[model samples]
Target: MNINSSICNLKFGLFFHLLFLSCSNRDEVKGQIPNVLFIAIDDMLPVLGCYGNSTALTPNIDTLANQGILFMNAYCQVGLSNPSRASLMTGMRPDEIKVWTLKPHFREEKPNVVTLPQFYKEKGYATRAVGKIYHDGAYHQDPVSWSNPSVLSVTRDGRGHKYVLPENYMPKRSKATTTENANVQDTAYIDGKVCQAAIELLNQLTDSTFFLAVGFRRPHLPFSAPKKYWDLYEREMFKKELKNPRRPARAPDFAFHNSNELRGYEDIGELGVIREEKQLELLHGYFASVSYIDAQIGKLIAELKRLGRYDNTIIVLYSDNGFHLGDFGLWGKTTNYEASVNIPLIFCGKGIEQGAINRSMVELIDIYPTLIDLTHGEMKSSHDGISLLPILKGKSSKVKSYALSQIVRPYQDAINSRSPDSMGYSLRTEKYRYIEWRNTKNMSVFARELYRMDDALSEKENIASDIKNEALMNQFSDIVNRIRK
Candidate 1:
């Protein structure tokens, strides 16, 4: 998992793609680029209405998805927080940037590289970001990128919720709530602040086009929201069980283990247990956060409509990465399982056909080039992601046949104490998921997993023994090799 290797791989792909396009491409159109409203969510899974989850509530997102195209098979390049965010900003994969964990800062990886916002700025769009748009703890702003950036004060994060915790309520790690807030607020977390800022910009900025990146940080960890959001769901009311009782039945032996940290949480077993009641509570909090965030989007859209910009703006909503409520005895996203890798991605507005759904395998990295296509015909031909513009325009069968997700350093300091740095790479298609880990001491091969997504629960059967699956294994191996290099 060398950073240089990742960069070289991206550079090679960019070069090859550009070479191919230059020789065969025809009929490229350039036009008045539509304004972009890039809405990003933190740790949000596809629990929205458009994704077909009846439990979760999200009106604004659902409306947006209906107004345009919904990407059913979108995924993130990395599973963790910081690296996932960094990959989106740089249009580079996590491995290429060598940003494996939350500890590393994006600045240290590629300070001079052009950021997504900076790219828009270069092309004359006023780029702005508010809330927890970057990594979790990153403060200030990317001085080289944003035209306007605002972050909520620490006091905002250390606030109390309007809802009361259970008599025995406590965080998973510590004895009690570490942060407290005095303000009774909506958009309580960073995303709330971001929404406010975006709405304000829409009112004041008279510019015909702008790049607005509004990121919300809720539904992440310590899942706390305002009391109203908490009150939205009653724990005693939830009766439906997980679609699969035994763990999704597809993946092989390697993909199903908790991280050392997760094991620690479960071992504490005091709080954050994935009990049915707790799962209901967590889902309630998540839905409320999404609903709260959706209200903000509604405000932004209203402003756009009032300003006569609604029809002209292209709004893309996506989650940086997915979250696992209690799937596979897991609470967070640090693995390559479906819950951790597959994310919600939807596009709306200007030139996109309405109510269309595409099941193409696409990654967050494709977003960079997709915008480039939407804004202008210019594209970094060397990038691994293809512009989804074709799919949006109803001209292509799918964006890519397969999506790739990778996780490096599965355990911070838990497994393989001698060699350290055990890594896992996964490939997801319309039907299957395959994961491979090395330098690890796990029963599943050098640490391998293969699952049939049709039945995602019921322990991922250890199919590593079935010699009949050789062709399947090779196909996945080839994808991993290309992505790894």
Candidate 2:
């Protein structure tokens, strides 16, 4: 062989070897990115066995909590479904996205903003959503967020006249009865269908990293579940803690509502405080629905395990927002109160500490940055929430000292005569909850509420009018004002 030819061949061989090594390293990094299993529940409060709710029969969720870090102080940015979901998915606050109400789609305001799943999809991960990841409506679904088309099921109870009186029957909107204990299988409900779809996707996933979001719609409204779940709890076993509780002292009338969401059913008449006897039945149905959803979650987790994807998947289970369950004479969300904001957040699987309970304040928007940090994905847009990766790894105890939540009450004089057009901005620190109700039109402070966290009736007592806590109230007001601008 000629010496020149041999030299050229050696150089070509060395170049190919270097190229192979670079490609191999890239593949290794891609393989190391763990799969994400995001489970979202609607209108779920922090009432679970792991969260110390003895009445909550959530063995699957409790098991997940035991195997993960249960965030004790995690809260939603807003209490409403569309606003809260949009905030977390976009990693932006409601103000930034301009999505404070259910009417406006987030994309309509920020058309180019990338969502959490879309971000993962951009990072070469296959993203799919089954069930109620976004709001339950068709307009709420984002087509750009998934690799394939998103799958959604009917959210109605589907019992029809079987559970309600024929005269008062309105299919999905009968107010005559709120709780339906249908004698049917779990698959008869929408959540069950969601589970089945998720399981099918899990079985089909191979040779690719994925972001599978399974959102369960249960324990939300109407409190419908299988009769077996209701059979798990006795009506006598359900205890009513606060019957006909008065509005918070010194709290603005705008802070309380007539449980309008609960009264939407045809069977339910005019808006009023639910009677104690009926409250027990509703509570039983809520718990029963929770248990039913827990069973569905168990099925999903079992499928992941069966597919050998449990260990390598990053499992995140959280709720969209908290529910009132008749707190403060309110039966729905949309207030800045703890019952509406505090949600259950659990992180399990790869790259997370197990059995760790974090009490530090965290927001739902933080989920976006946390997942980005975990997968080493790049962020193309700004985010209001800080990453909780340090807290998840036990490197830090707290990310932010305060978590903020807000709600806007539109001009609805006919619907809610007492709650005029106002905006409720609440800030929660480790020791206090400060709320400011501002006029929506003029942006002037209408009323204020201050509650010490150490008090048993912190939310029940509004110390904004107390002269003794004037300094503390000023400090909180300053914080809220700074953020407001």
Report clash pairs, candidate 2: 174-266, 174-267, 175-265, 175-266, 175-267, 175-268, 176-266, 176-267, 176-268
Query: 343 in model 2: Cα distance from truth in Å?
Result: 0.7
TM-scores, one per candidate: 0.81, 0.89
364-449: candidate 2 lDDT, tens digit per residue: 98899998888775555577778999988889998888888988875243233323466788999888898887886787987788
> Distance from true position, residue 310, model 2, in Å?
0.8
Distance (Å) between predicted and true CA of 375, model 2? 1.2
Candidate 1 lDDT tens digits, 178-268: 1122234665444566667678877766643588877777666545566665566565544562434355544444444552333343223
Best by lDDT: 2
Root-mean-square deviation of Cα positions for candidate 2 versus the true structure, in angstroms = 4.5
Quantify how close model 1 is to the true structure by its C-alpha RMSD in Å. Answer: 12.9
Candidate 1 worst ten-residue window by lDDT: 173-182
Give lDDT: candidate 1, residue 27: 16
